[model samples]
Target: MVHNCVFSFKLSSAREGIRSEKVRELIPDMLSSYTVNIAYHANNPDVGMALEKDAGRYKLFNSDVGLFITLAFKDKKYTENIIYNKLLSDKLDVNLGYVYENVVAQMLIAKGNNLFYYTMESKTSNHLYEIDFLTSVKDKICPLEVKSGNYRTHKSLDVFCNKFSNRICNKYVVHTKAYKWENGIYYIPVYMIPFL
Candidate 1:
């Protein structure tokens, strides 16, 4: 199921160990399922500018936003239908970052952009700088960070753009906030993702 894939992906990407073989196998199977359903395909961005030989580093998305919305609540028979209406009306108390991330991924996919993200590995510590999404425009990469709230500390996006300034076109923080320009990062509303 897509929920399991999302959980597994989040765990692995967060550097948490997945001990179950069944859980490991479900990830690829979910990828294939999404592809077969014409929803989305896997995207693997290289750790650096140059392409890496390994395809292990990747992200999966739902190409259809509607399908993704439905997939999010597939587990609960009673609550599944309720979430859709509540989420649309901004009534849900639960954290909506995963939903927003999925929609952003869907929008990027619809725009014909491959879903890619950047993360810097730390040698001495577990700390890492992670950009939520990356897109190429005019020969430069644009880094985006998705947030569910107005809390505006974007250290990852800042560090990434700073280190890769010459290779970056723009920096963005997508959230529920209205449009604003601050310290070079554009804070845009979630609905405006397609226009970006």
Candidate 2:
């Protein structure tokens, strides 16, 4: 339950050399066994099995974050993993957006919530604006953006809310901050997400 503290990861393919297609085939079984959880990227504000979602573009999170952390350090000896060393000194200088997203998935799932997200390519740039999580409430959508550390902006959430204000009921920026509500958005502390 280390909710905060900074960490980052660079994308890397699986070390076992399993083809991604084969991995995809095994995912249904994994999901059924609670080995993994999936957050779909939806095209609209629908929930449950009725969502118009992209099966091809989704985020996968391990069902257990502690196990995921342990598996991330698969060294023969504990002293050899560079990440473990950095983590010990509290000097990790990485962006761990995925980690926070994984924990949020766990909390949401534990509270019987299904996960969804939204992403759109920027009109002016080649980059994409991504809302980290999206939930439907009373037929309107709620967009959540997760930020770690002393960050002060929610660019993706802003863009999403601006475009879909009519379809949105609430906007949330979840981070390591005190709970507050301002400007039509709720600033929720990360620890309180389970009760949300």
Candidate achieving the largest lDDT? 2
lDDT of 1 by residue, 61-145 (tens): 5656677667666776545656778888888788877678877877777787656666675556888666778776777777889
TM-score of 1: 0.72
The positional error of residue 153 in candidate 1, measured at the CA in angstroms, is 1.4
In model 1, which regions exceed 4 Å deviation?
A: 1-50, 80-82, 122-124
Could you give the C-alpha RMSD of every candidate to the true structure, in order shown? 5.5, 5.6
Cα displacement (angstroms), candidate 1, residue 186, comes to 1.0
What is the Å distance of residue 92 in model 2 from its true position? 4.2
Worst 10 residues of 2 by lDDT: 1-10
Best-matching candidate per TM-score: 2
Q: Rate the local accuracy (lDDT) of all candidates.
A: 0.65, 0.72
